[model samples]
Target: MVESFHEFVVHRSPALCRTAYLLTGDHQLAEDLVQTALARTYRHWRRVRDGNPEAYVRRVMYHQQVSWWRRRRLVERLEAELTERADTDHSEATTLRLSLDAALRQLTPRQRAVIVLRYYEDLTEAQVADALGCTLGTVKRHGHDGLRRLRAVAPELVDATAERSTR
Candidate 1:
């Protein structure tokens, strides 16, 4: 069991850490979050190993993210970092990616989590709700609210999409 768990962690850790980094936008904090979540998951391995352990760890990560947000006022500090860089390379796709990432950083942690899970991970509403331990309605509300906020902040994206449609 220990060997199997170790192997599982080795294989899944990168993806988990990537998700954590996207959720937090801080490498050190993401590492801590993933480590903490994995540790907690390890404690209940027997019960969770057979089930969707990835979902269990993701839930732990989401809860830990929320708790961290509540406990610290770090989001304000992050705003400056989010806007500090503007992608000015030749690649339009890279610029759009950077712009979208910056826009996502402006959202609240829960809203960001909802957006990441729904869009990046392409999880269904029920899956997102289950992962976040929220009701499906809350998941839908968060997704709606997050997109609304993103649209408000990123009118350029909307304009770009409109231009594409017309062309």
Candidate 2:
């Protein structure tokens, strides 16, 4: 059981951390969140081991993210300061990733979580609600609100593919 759990962590850690980073917009915080979620999963391995362990860990991550958002005003303050230092002359994909990350940071935590779970993780609305411990209606609202905010902030992103093709 321990071996299986360890293997699962090794396999899933990168994707989990990436999802967390996209959700939180901080690498260190994302790592910490993934670690905490994995630890919780480890603790309940016996109960969650046989059936969708990844789902259990994802729920922990989502709840932790929401709790962190609720509890930490300092996080946003620090992020505001850190944004000024985020310049990079990387590839277009990298730049777009950064832009998307910045746009995502502007959203409420629930909205960001819904976008990550729905688009990034490719989960259905029902699955997202189940993962978030909210109603499906809430998930749909968040998704719509998140996309609306993204479109509002990054109008160019709507034509991103066309822009890239011309470049």
Residue-level lDDT tens digits of model 2 in 1-167:
99999999999999899888987889999999999999999999999989888878888998898888888765352232233345645566865766677788888889999999999999999988888788999999999999999899767666785687898
lDDT of 1: 0.85
lDDT against the true structure, per candidate, is 0.85, 0.85
Residue 114 lDDT in model 1?
92
TM-score of 1: 0.84
lDDT of 1 at 110: 85
- Top candidate on TM-score is 2
Please provide, for model 1 over 1-167, each residue's C-alpha lDDT reduced to its tens digit, 9 standing for 90 to 100. 78878988999999899889889877899999999999999999989889988889999999998898889876443232233346535566755666677778888888999998888888899999999999999999989999999899877777777887898
Any runs in candidate 2 off by more than 4 Å, and if so which?
Answer: 75-90, 161-167
**Model 1 misplaced stretches (Cα beyond 4 Å):** 77-90, 159-167
